[model samples]
Target: MSTVLEILHIARFGLAGVFLLGGGFFVLAGAIGVLRLPDFYTRLHAAGVTDTMGSTLILLGLMLIAGFTLLSVKLALVGLFLFLTSPTATHAVANAAHKAKLKPLLGTYRQTRKGDNEGGSQ
Candidate 1:
């Protein structure tokens, strides 16, 4: 019985640690993407992806660490709140930016004057 309990304890901690580490990596990648990418929409993408996934995983790991207690319940409630709020907040920000005339990275460029002569002199 004692051995079984010990194994469960170890498994819980190990799994929780893994989840936390994974969540941390997601956050780090999001941060890097935000920094490397230009423009408001792209940065918003990075922040949204990280905020949703990273927080979910981190909160799940924390719930596991907390086990069956009030703290776990609180964590779950927090997770639910975030799940409901993150995407809405992201959409709100993005919509506001759009209304303010922000544009996404469209990967299109205007032809230079030097190249104008190539197409029969515009």
Candidate 2:
């Protein structure tokens, strides 16, 4: 292949790698959020938003690698399906929780660093 074509190919793969890494990061962050968050609602919010975004980015990376092929078309369809369904599912769950009288924690949450505490400096 020509130098320009080779460069283009390298650029495509590089971009795909970036997208895949970004998707992985978002998914990892979402997992951490779910584990660390204080309440069901907050955890749900983290999971819902990041799950959709993360999957979309990952699928996009896969599509880029697949190029103009049947596999890419299928991936696009799957992405569309998830993009539509995930938010709907999240909303449904939230609504059910609300109907069941599950309330989110309200008010302020304060966390002090190691050196700072009730003693005021150390």
Candidate 3:
């Protein structure tokens, strides 16, 4: 019984560590995306991804490390708030952009087949 308790504690710690590390990587990737992406829309998309996944993972890690306590409860509340706000904020920004008449970047298309070129514009 004692050994089982000890193992459970160890497992909890390990899981908590994994969650924290994974969250950290997500945050790192998001940061890179923000820095490297071009245009306002793309940058905002990167930022939104960062805001959503990054905060969620970090908060989840904090909750795991906290265990069953007031701290964990508080973290849960904060996580809920982040989940609700992130998307709303992103949508609000997008709406603002639309109102401003900003055009999104368009991608160029090409045909793979030689025969398809005849059907397309010369």
Q: Rate the local accuracy (lDDT) of all candidates.
A: 0.81, 0.82, 0.76
lDDT: which is higher, 2 or 3?
Answer: 2
Give the Cα-based TM-score of candidate 1 against the true structure: 0.83
Task: Provide TM-scores for the models.
Answer: 0.83, 0.86, 0.81
Say which candidate scores most in TM-score. Answer: 2
lDDT tens per residue, model 2, 43-101 = 99789757687998899999989999999999999998888888988999989888777
Q: Could you give candidate 3's per-residue lDDT for residues 37-72 as a string of tens digits?
A: 645577788887667777887788788788899999
Model 1 root-mean-square deviation: 6.7
Task: State, as a TM-score between 0 and 1, how close model 2 is to the true structure.
Answer: 0.86
lDDT of 2 at 100: 76
Q: State the lDDT at 104 in candidate 2.
A: 62
The number of clashing residue pairs in each candidate reads 0, 0, 0
